[model samples]
Target chain A: MFEHLHAGLLAAVSMSNLIALFFGTFVGIVVGILPGLGPMVGMVVLLPFSFAFSPDVALSLLLGVFCGGYFGGAVPAVLLRTPGVPSSLVTSFDGYPLTQKGEAQTALSAALLGSFGGGVISVVILIFLAPALAHVAASFGPPEYFAVAVFGVVLVVMAFREQFARGIMLLGLGFWFSTVGIDGTTLSERFCFGTLSMQNGLDIVPICLGLFGIGQTLILVERDIMKTNDIKLSRSTLDFSAIVKVLKYWKTLIRSGVIGTFVGLLPGTGSILASFLSYDVAKRLSKEKERFGKGTPEGCLASEAGNNAVPAGAMIPLLTLGIPGDALSAVLLGVFTINGIYPGPLLLVKEPVLISTIYISMLLINVVAFLMLIIWLRPFAMIVKVPGKLLAVVIMVISMIGIYAVNTRLFDAGVAIAMGVLGYILLRMGWPVVTLIMGVVLGEIMENRLRETLSLGDGSLGILFQRPICIFLIVLTSLIILIPFVLDIRKNIRNKKLNQF
Target chain B: MPKKDYYSSRAHDLLGSIFGVFALSMLITSPWQVDTSGPDPFYKGPLIFPLIVFCLMLAGSLPSLWRLFRPSEKSSWYLDGQGKPFKTMVILGLLIIYLAGIIFIGLEVSTWLFLLIALKLVNQDSILKLTLIPVLVTLILFVIFKYFLDIWFPEPLIMEIFLE
Candidate 1:
């Protein structure tokens, strides 16, 4: 391990790789700080260039973006009450409150420090645990894969417990969308409705840009962007004391990091879930729970730490099983495939040095991005003062161009605009758009794996229950689904008893 | 009951039922033809997942539809803040126009025009700043996407005529 780290360090320090890392991190920060444009869009925009660069350089660039984007989102969340990325929504629950209380500098410092710590811890886990996890993943077959995919869908539904029905409905909608293209086995089109472009199926790029980017822009427009009050930043600098103040929440940081890494290991469960779960856990465990949404440093620490850890955790499934743990990692899979670096169990065996270099690069990216953000903290705070109308125009233009640039197809731009309209309607109707996107991401995998499992079993459904791993996953999924209901029942009974007394 | 409360109360169920009808139509109109010659003929069809999904959609919508007819707590129908309907309509209309313009006039010109119009609608800023900002931003984006990344934007009919 030490020897591998040494080799990785040497490779990562190369001039070209260093330059890629710097630029990737810079683009990531810019994309993340801008509302509605998350790391996924940034990576997608840069994906075409990955074909021109070496695998190490390409991977470094994307990883830098992935890391920097997660931390960069906290800037707007803390200062402007607008989350640059969905994962930072939880951060703003406390971060924006801190800003309102004239503690924006403290909140920013805490978030950055928490992000750095979580990033480092997650990398250490990746370095030590990924190889062993890959070994276990190597033993998995179609039935196990099918079970894990089912577990992912269920976990996503569970994440939106308050809106379970809406989540499930959106998931169904996503599944329907996934079935549009030519079937892998039969080559028969499912739901193209006679349109030739529909036969190619909907691309994730347009869906993301439409739902997250354009949809968000429309909502912002309705909110009257020009009328929003400018946020005033406190005059205090993020000094040594602020750093020390954040370090006091070390326990929250570490716990959130662990939770994030584990949740991130699940296929299709993304960083948003990890952050929300960590925030919930932190609030539940804190003695001063009443202070949770009211400018508590611990709350910000938990959310920032959890979200920043997700990219490393997501790498586990992508590297070991060739399956992406989340949408962002799914895009990374495309980058890997384009660069002729197929990620599977053999990837580690064939390119151990390259993988190690990626790990080293991620570690370096976290530190470099943190320092750069701290140096430019004041400037970023001032970005919130930019008129919302200008921001909306820029976002709309970028989203349109970015979607069109993917395949140079006007039809894709149409698809994006259509999805944007649908997304806005769904948002107004109180539906969860993330679930729909997740369903689309996981649907193909589930269908392919289920078909494979059935073929292996000669059409016997019993085979799915026969494997120990499959059974374990089934039981786990059942528990995840049922526990909330049981808890609800217990609460109801207790309330009734108290009323009788 | 107030008109807003009445609409808000029925919105979820109305939307759910509409979605259910759409799902049913999709399931019924599925175009996948099963390959009976294959060894696993039944499993080879592409419509199985879609069928399951549509069924789930119908199932999920049923409860909401049922609740619509039953007495329920009052809910606000207005999703956005009051007096913003005009702004919402204009923004959506602008988006639709932008999409059409992209196909008709090309991405660069349409994007520039869209930005100017959208900014004018939302802000009282000087015409120069709006024009310059959009022009500058568009040129920068065009260079980065076209020259650096090698993305090809479709040429408008006017440009093609001029070139010819």
Candidate 2:
């Protein structure tokens, strides 16, 4: 462990990696402070650049943005009462009320410091817990992988159970898209439509850029959301005294960090839920329970710590299990795979140095983002005044050009545009856009493992039942799919009995 | 409770039918799209995996689609109404033209023009924002893409004559 950490410390301090870390985090904070644009869009737009650097640098840049965005998300929530990231909505409950009481500094400071503390704790947990988790995951064979992929998909669909059919249809669409280009197993062309571009298969980066970047821009434009609010921020600065004040709530920080990381460990449960859960618990446990909804530093600390802890916690799953816990981590999976660094049991065994560097880089990013937020708090707060529409337009253009730069391919840009339309249609229809991405990310592993498992069993799925882990995964997936239907049937039966009475 | 769906039931039926038709196409085209000529049986063919997925999708969509058409069932199959598709479509049109513009005109010129028009569309109240922000943004993008990032941009068709 010392050897790996020593190597990580060396790699992390390299001039290029350090620069990438700072740059990615800065961009992350800027985007996170902006309304309607969050880490996912920032990561996708910047994903093309990730290929230019080594995997260590690439992951650092993207992960910096991932963690940094959470730190910055608290700003707009506190100052403007608009959660820059959806997860930061919890922060706003106490954050905004504090701003109204002219205590914005205390609120924002506690939020940032608590975020910093939670982020560090989460990384510590990941550094210790992930390797042990990977040891168990090392035993995961083709059947286990296949079953787990199905479980991941089931979790995502169930998260959007309100539109179950829509989720399945979009998942099917993403799976279909993944099957385009040459089939690796058979070396046979599939779904190319006689186009050379399709022969290479669709890249996840461009599709993400389209969906979250361009497609989201269109939604914002249609809503005319930019014209709705004029953003203004009074002067706010974080001092050492504020940090001292925030540190007084160390218990809240630790508790929320644990809750956040544990929630993040679960697949498909997002940071919003983590923040809310942490806030509820903190409120319930507090002697000043009445102070939660009103302006209180403890409330901001709890919520911010919870949300900030989530990125590292989510990375725990992504880095070890090769399964993303949420949409941001799912995109991060693309970066990992693109660099030929597939995260699984093999990752910990094979690339201990890279893993350690990621841990160190995550820690460095938290420190750097916290300091940057403190020093330039006013500027970041002020940039929030930029109209959402302009940001949308800028993001859309960057997405197109950035995606084109990936391989200098016009076809990728076209794919992005096409997916943008599909994403927009889905979003308008009230379907979650990220479900398609989740399906796409898991599709390859699912297919490859299922095929491998089938060949092992001579084309019989009974092999899945034989494995303990696969059986557990399958049973969980089955329950997820069946429980809603069973409950609805019970409801109907009860209603009929009441009517008869 | 769910918000009263903004879109009427008819629009929702359209969405359901789209999925229904898409599923049907996948099922119909699977045989041709997937080759099964190897020594292996159809189950082992490249088609099996996608086939399984499409079947599951059909299972999900078909029930919903069936219920949509049945008047005796819940007649209020609904959608979260599209907020302003006409506006979004207009932006889409602009984006299509922008892509075309990049192919014909150079990236710098087309981007400047695209941002100018886009800014004007979004913030008609600010003339300076429409005129200046575009130029500033374009300049910044050029510096970053050209020098800092070292990204390659495709030369426009007009540049072909200059090359010759």
Candidate 3:
């Protein structure tokens, strides 16, 4: 392990890797500080270039974007009451209040420090935990793999408890989309419609770019971009004292980081869940609970720490089991497969140096993002003042060009436009979009694995129950589904009784 | 009790109705459209998954479509094209033209013209910004794509007719 780390250090420090780290982090910060454009969009835009670069350089670039996005999201949340990423919405709860109370500098400092601390702890957790998990996962058979996929789907379904049916419906939609291409097991055209493009099936890059990049732009353009011109950052400046002041909440930082890492380990639970969970836990633990929403720096710290830890924590399953936790990691998985680097149990053994380099790169990405934010927090906040329309046009141009540049297929451009339209429609609807995309991403694995398991059992559903892992997953998913459903019924009944009285 | 358009939910319902129609169509047409023949036909059976998907979609959409027709105040009966949709349509039209431009005119001129029109439409009234931003953006795009990455854009259709 130590030898691998040493070799990883050497590879991570190569000029190309360092350049990618800097450039990716820089792009990530800019994207994160901008509303509606998060790390995923930035990563997708950089995806084309990734195909050309070495694995270390490409992974570092995307990793930088992923972690740097979280680090930078807190800026707008702190100063402008606008969270650059959804995960930072929790930050604004306390952060914006601090801004109003003339303590923007302290809020920003605390958020950044918490992010730095969380990032470090997450890497530590990844180092210690991932290998053990990989070792355990090495014994998994098709039944277990099939069970894990189902478990992953259920985990995501449980995440969107508020919109249960819609989440599932969208997931089904994504699954259908995944099945559109030639069947992996059968090599039969399911819905090719006698077209060559349809015969080849859909690629994730174009779909993702269209959905996020183009779709997000269409939404942003409908509003006045210059409306944020009134926001001023004159009084909101950071100092060394702010850092010292933020460190006083070391307890919150550590707790949130651990909570985040644990939650992140759960498949399908992304950074937002981590942030919300950590913030809620901190609120429950704090003696000054009343002060939480009213500019409590600890609240800001917990949320940032929680969200920042997720990328590394999520990387574990991705490295060990080849399962991605969220859209961002799914895209990372896409990149890995495209590069002929399949991440599973064998990955740890086959590419120890590559894996370790990624680990080392993750740690450096956090530090680089932290230092950059500290130095340029002021200029970075200024980005929020840019007109939304201008940014919209920019997304349109780049996404269109980026999609075309990848393989130069005109049909891909058509697919992107169609996807962009679909994405816009989905976004406009109250229906959950993530589930659909996840369905599309994870659907193929579930379909193939489930069919394989069934075929092994001579097409008997009872075969799933024969395996301990599959039985455990089935029971767990049942409980997860049933508990909330029973509780909802009880709540409704109690409400009816109260109305009768 | 008109349902607030929040998140374009009514539009979602409209799409739901469409999905219902899609499911119905697929159920009727799968015999012709889907080809499930292969080795281990049971394992390779493509129809099984689609059947499951079709059932899920119908189950999810039927209730929503029923709700759409029930005349309830909790939802709208029609889709409200929203958020300066006219502007959005115009821009979408411009996007279609831009995409067509890449195939017809070539990458260079198309990008510049598209940017120029798009920047102007977004209310950048300055001649300098309109002119300079396009030139710079086009140059950067050209350099990065053409010179740096060496991607080949579709040749202009006119190249076939003209002696170059």
Candidate 4:
């Protein structure tokens, strides 16, 4: 394994791959800091380019985007009081407040250093642990995959803190949307409705862009009035002392990284869940819990660690089961397929070098992003100083061109427009687009897995629980779904009694 | 009831009615087809999920509908000092119009035109800044799609003549 790592490191750090790494990380940072354009959109826009390069080069670029994008989310969260992605929502809690108090550099430096620490820890874990995880994942069958999918749906319910009915409704809607394309076994189309585009079902990318980017942008556009009474950021940022302070918070980093890795390993549990859970955990464990929302550095560390650690953690499942762990991983899976490499347990044995190469590349990607963040730190801060309207126009133009550049299909452009509008409406109604997009992204894979599991029996229900892994997952998912509701009910009951006095 | 409660109830009812209408529409317009293949449980297996979703939608919407007709005691809604919900509604309305235009005029033209109109209506900026920024942006997008990324967009009818 050490020998393989040496070889992989040599191959990954070749001049060309390094250049790709730098370029990809730079693009990712820009995309991450820009509102509405998250890593998935960046990946999709760059997916077609993957076809033009070797699989390793492709991974380098996209992985760079994935890693850099996670850290990039902190930029806006700190400076503009806007979270570039849902995962960065926790960042803004303390981040924006810190910015208001004229310590933007301090907040930014802490987030950057925290991101690097959590990311490096997870990468080490990914390196040593991914191979073993692959061994465990090798035992998984269709039933196990289905169970995992079930677990994912349950996690979505927990992660989404909105109305229970609405979340369930969205899940049902996602399942329905998943069934749009052709059936797995029989060469039959279910809801094609005679449209060629619908036959392929909905592409998760356009739908996601429409929902998060377009929809959120419209909401921002509508509520265009600036809310911040004052905007001030100290440009003279010092890192060494700040780094020392953050290093003392290793317990926070480790806890958040573990939480992030666990969430990432779970199919469909993305960084948003990790960050929120980490923030909640940090708050629960902190000495100064009351200071959390009012600009605590611990809050910054937790949120940054939570979001940045996700990509590495998410890569575990994708490399192991070929079941993408998140939206970005799904696109990466597409890149692997396009390159004629199917990622699964077999991939560990057949392409051990490839696996190690990716791990090593991820390590380098973070380093490159760290360096780029340092070089571009001041410019990034200046980015927020631009008027909101100007920023919107720039994002709009980029989105249009990016979408057009990818497929060049007018139909796809139309699809994006439709999706954007639908997304905007869903946002206005307070519907969680993450759940909807998760459904769209994982719909086909889950359906195929479900069909495979169902076919394994004499059509008996016993097949779903026959596998020990499946049974364990089934139990886990059931607990995930019920625990929150039970807690909420208990809290309500206790509160009612307390108020009665 | 207080006058504020009367308006709030009306708003709740309107929301409930909208969902109720949408739910009903799904039941009516869901392209339910007959599967003529072997041992069909119902004529339409495809319709099952949609029908289930519609039923759930109707059921879920009931609380909002009930609140519209009868005031609820358990809930409280807050308003800020200067916030006018009606103004927010109008802004939302303008956004809907801008989104609708994306479908008709295409993304570039629609977005550019929307920004111009939005700036004019909202007094967000001077005409010079608003007008110049849109075209500059449109060109940047054109270069990105056409040159940088090699994405092909259907030139808007206005640009179609000149570019072609």
Candidate 5:
């Protein structure tokens, strides 16, 4: 392992590989600053170019894009309040507030440093523990997967503080949408309703654009119309003392990074949940919990580190088990497929060098992100000062055109618009759009796995319980779901006692 | 807690009842006939999942509807129909029209017209910015998708005659 590590580091330092890292990270930052474009789109768009380079160099370039893209999202999220990608939504909580308070430099610096630390730590985990983790993941069967999916649904219920019925409705609607394409087992179209585009099912990008961009932009327009003060850029200089203040919270930083990597390693659950969970955990543990929403650096470390650690964490399940841990990793699986590299049990023995190359590339990209942040902090901060109304129009138009360009089908644009309206209505009713999105993406995986489990004969649902890892997952999920309800009931009882007093 | 709370809860009760009934009816009336003999023989087949989901939907709606009628301690988050539903309805209607138009009028024209109207709808205050942005965007997108990305779009009827 040490020998492979040395080889990987030397390979990473080659002139061509270093150049590839720089180029990928540079493009990633630009794409991250732009709204409605994400690492998946960036990867898919660049897939064809991979044919032009060697496998090692291509992997280096793509991993560079992945690591750099995660940090890049912080640029727009902190500066423009646009949340350049979905994972960055958590960053906007303290990040934007810090920016408004004229500490844009401090906020961005904390985010960059936290992102770098978390990413490197996660890569280290991947390097040392991936084969062992893959052995564990291989033991997981359909029933355990189903239990995890149920845990994801329950997490959505707890996180979303709206009427439970509406949230469930969104889940049901998403599940129904998932059944639209051809049934994978039965080979019959469930709800194509005569359109070929729907036959492939709704594209995730179009659905995402409608829910977040168009739906969100409309809400932004309404807010802007009602808002009193225009968006103002902060003029605060970066203070060295502020950097030292964040360093004081190093324990919280490491804890959040570990939590994020663990969450990322979990199948189906992704960065969005990891970031929010870290925020909640940080708040619960902090002496200044009440100050979290008001630009606390501890809050920044928890969320930024939590989200940034996820890309590396996501690669764990993908490289080891052939299961994608999140949406972006799912696309990376496709890239691996295109390059004739099957990422499963055989990957460790058959292609150990390739795996080492990816790890080395991930580490190098974090350094690139840090350097980019230092040079471009002020220039990037200027993004928020773009007039809100103008920024909105650009987002809307780009969303419309980008969705249409995917397959050259205007029907997709229609699907996006209809969803946009539905999303707007759901927003008015206080339903959680993010939970609905999670349902849409994860529901199909859960459904297919459930079907597979039930198909196994001899009534051995106990087959799932046979494996120790499966048993552990079942116990853990039960605890996660039940503990929340128990806590909620306990709080209610305590509140009743207080009221009586 | 407030009068606004009472009214909103009542409204949710009504809306949930309507949606619940609609969902149940769709389940019953949906054209899902079970064919058992294809590839896999299992108890929990394709139709079973849909049926279970429908049952869950109806069951979930019952408690919410009961709360609406009885006014329970739970708070409701519904706002009182704040924006005009009809304007959104019109935008949806135009989108459908644009989809149908794509088969006849082709991609560029329908896309151009759809975006122009969508821009107008989103930014009603700035006509000049709205008009200028959409046109420039459509052309630039045309270049990116057509020349650079090299994906195929339906050629306009005029371009089909002239360029071909």
Candidate 6:
């Protein structure tokens, strides 16, 4: 492995590869910093250009964008209290609080370091464990996949432990939305109501934009536009001390990275779930759990690291199984196919040098992107000082344009506006929108897998119980859901005993 | 002194439950059926998942409706304080107008109008700054999407006239 990595490093050091990496990273960061634009969009926009370059150069460029985009979203999340992408939503829980406390520099540093650590760690994991993990993933049959999907959704609801009921309701709504399109198995339209557009179901992009972007804009508009002068930036640009402080939570960084990689290896579970699950796990492990949503560096670190790890971890499945882990990897799959390099079980056997080059390029791009962000930290931080009213207009315009640009569909823009209104209402009611997103992400997978499992069993429900992996997942899901309630009951009982005394 | 608790009206809860019930009724009554002809004859139709969701929604909303009738202390439904409802309504109204404008007029013209209205609602910026910012933002977006990314938008009446 080390020998291959060395060969890859030698291949990746060419001037053309380096230049492509730099440009891709630059574009990725810019795209990520803008609300409603994510790594998928960045890759999609640049995909045409990939046809012009060699496979190694093209893959390096796209992977650079993928890595940089994940980290770039954290910038807006920490400073502006707006997540540039769905995964960054977890980052903003504590990131925005730190910003409000005038520690935006500290937050940005932690985010960058966490992202860098995650990227490197996941690449390492990908290098060593890709074959083993892919074998495990390949064993996941329909029942196990269904169980995993259920587990992911349950984890999302559990992430909002205080508001589990509300989360469940929102998740149900998300699942319903997912079922709106034509049924894949039965070849029947479900909830289109005769509309051609609705037959395709709701797009995740518009939903995200409506919930996070437009919804946030409405709140800013209602707050009377926060004044730019009110925000005070600290003297330091990239705080080494703050970075050191975050490093103290090395356990959290490592754990979240591991969690992210494992989740990313799952074909359908995306980075959004990975980050949320990581944040939840971090909070559960923290001695100072109360500080989690209130400017805790640990929260930001966990989320940033968890999401940043996904690019490499996602590659594990794409390379070994010919299965893209998520949307971005799906796009990368197309890029690979276009470049005449089909990734499957035989990929490593056939194209060891090319695979190694890709790995080395990823490592270099991750480091370069982090360094560039640190150098440009001050300018990024200064964006928050833009007049809130002006920023609001900018956000709205960008969101509208971004939604429209996705498929050049006016219907998507309308969906975004409608969702924006719904999100605003839900926000006012203190409902968890993140859970809804998770449900949408996992719902189709669960439904389809469940149907497949049932069909395989000839409609016998016992098939789920018969599978060892499914049983294990079911038990894990039950434990995760039940442990909190059990803890709450124990706390209540102890309090009652004390009151008796 | 102990903190005083304020309770909001149960209107939202009532409406939510009503919507759930309505959705459930529609799901039950819908004629669109799933094709179960392929091999698996016993497979429940496509309506099953949606029906399950509506049922869950109904079940979840029931407690909220019950609490509404019982008159318990709750936070206010309004996100901001009094008089902000008007502001929210105005913003939502503008959003609706913007959507309509995008369809009828075009992206550039609609975006310009939306920004001007939205900015005026949110802040008391100078007319020149507001005008310049919106026009520049619209142009930059147009260039990025239309010229660079090759995304298409309906040509506005004004743009058509200018081209002619």
Query: Which residue pairs clash in candidate 3?
Result: A225-A388, A428-B7
- Tell me the deviation in Å of residue A392 in model 5: 4.2
DockQ top scorer: 3
**Cα lDDT for residue A116, candidate 6:** 91
lDDT of each residue in A1-501, candidate 4, tens digit only: 888888788889888788888888887887787665667666666664555568888899999888888878888888777886668888989988888887776677778876887788788888777789888877888788778766766666556654555555555566566666665444456667677777766555455555555555555555553334244654433455656766777899888887887777776567888889988999999988998999987898898888888888888877877766666786787678657798777798898777878989998888878777766676754554445545544454355445544555545555666777766666665555566665665566666665566567545548876778888888887887778889989999999999998
What does candidate 1 score on TM?
0.85
lDDT of 2 at B47: 85
Interface RMSD, every prediction, one decimal place: 2.6, 1.7, 1.8, 5.0, 3.6, 3.0
Q: RMSD of each candidate?
A: 4.2, 2.5, 2.3, 5.5, 5.9, 6.9
DockQ of each: 0.50, 0.58, 0.61, 0.21, 0.33, 0.43
Going through the candidates in order, what is chain B's TM-score?
0.74, 0.80, 0.83, 0.57, 0.65, 0.71
Give the per-residue lDDT of model 3 (tens digit) for A112-132.
Answer: 999999999999999989899
Per-residue error for A174 in candidate 6, Å, reads 1.5
Off by over 4 Å in 6: A1-115, A224-365, A497-501, B1-19, B30-44, B73-85, B157-164
Candidate 5 chain A: worst 10 consecutive residues by lDDT?
Answer: A225-234
lDDT of 5: 0.68
Cα lDDT tens digits, model 3, B1-164, are: 23345523455666777887788788778757778656556554887777777777777787567766664575553454454467667777788888999988888888899888888888877998888878888898889888998999988876666855
Q: Which residue pairs collide in model 4, if any?
A: A405-B151
Instruction: Compute each candidate's TM-score over C-alphas.
Output: 0.85, 0.94, 0.95, 0.78, 0.74, 0.72
Docking class of 1: medium
Clashing pairs in 5: none
Please list the residue runs of candidate 3 whose C-alpha ends up more than 4 Å from where it truly belongs after superposition.
Answer: A225-237, B1-10, B77-84
Better of 4 and 5 by lDDT: 4
Model 2 segments more than 4 A misplaced: A226-235, A488-501, B1-10, B71-83, B148-150, B161-164
Candidate 4 per-residue lDDT over residues B19-125, each given as its tens digit:
66677676676654312243423312344445655676577566666765576675444322223435334444554564455545666777677567655544457
